[model samples]
Target: KRILYIMIALCLTSFVANYSMSSGAIASEKKDGEKVKKTTAKDPICGMEVQKDKSTKVEHNGKNYYFCSERCEETFKKEPSKYERKTKKGNEISDLSKE
Candidate 1:
């Protein structure tokens, strides 16, 4: 009887440990994917709205540039003069630049 009880306790402990480990991994993955969808901005160069995961970002001239596509980023890089206008305040700019 004591041996049976010990085996049952071990089985229960292993099951609990496995359950917690899998759940923790699933929760973290959900969090990671969720972080990308929270907020989005419009790409000034291409005039398209971009989500966090979907946007290509570049840091230049003490600012972060968000682009709707890689083509837009290339365009901005090739002729930065065309897109030098700053529309947001410094604090707002900083907030959008965060990862």
Candidate 2:
């Protein structure tokens, strides 16, 4: 009967919609609890490694600097030139290259 066919079609459509929605919700839940590794950068003032995401960040001269602690951050803030990168010149070597 036409009514029987319509009922079957509606049931199938409802089942498919529910299946898709539940699958999408499970996918989103997995993504919500995903763990990501954080990258590390050296504290310029103390030379200690610190996680980029967890450390205090400061920007100087268009560059970002990460610090292990507020003390180191303050030290760099006071004299950033002391921790600024040095470039190697002709017949010369950069100190950073040695590390």
Candidate 3:
């Protein structure tokens, strides 16, 4: 039926559009060609996803940490160790900026 064919075409178009958008979001990288996926990070101060390039950022202790707001940034600046990312394994993500 023509209606069935139209629905199929629409579905395919939607699939293609979504695929491209998802792929494009992950196509970003750092200056050293390290691929950083546009995924969620727990904002040090608020536990929100700090999206790639879309979230507000502050460079601290030689690594770039993302924040949900200026208030969170100020909070982290005052006591960075308290706000630093900690792994579930009881380790901290190394901030190599000091090197």
Best by TM-score: 2
| lDDT of each residue in 1-99, candidate 3, tens digit only | 975455445434533544445434533456467775445344565554444344456787677776555555677789988766566786667531211
Predictions in order: lDDT: 0.52, 0.56, 0.55
User: Which parts of model 1 are misplaced by more than 4 Å?
Assistant: 1-38, 86-99
Q: TM-score for each prediction?
A: 0.45, 0.51, 0.48
Candidate 1 lDDT over 1-99, as tens digits, reads 975455445434544444444423322244635732334454556444455444578776676677755556676788865566644663332323433
Point to the candidate with the largest lDDT: 2
Worst 10 residues of 2 by lDDT: 90-99
Ranking by lDDT: 2, 3, 1
- Taking all chains together, the TM-score of candidate 3 against the true structure is 0.48
Q: Which one wins by TM-score: 2 or 3?
A: 2
Q: List the residue pairs that clash in candidate 2.
A: none
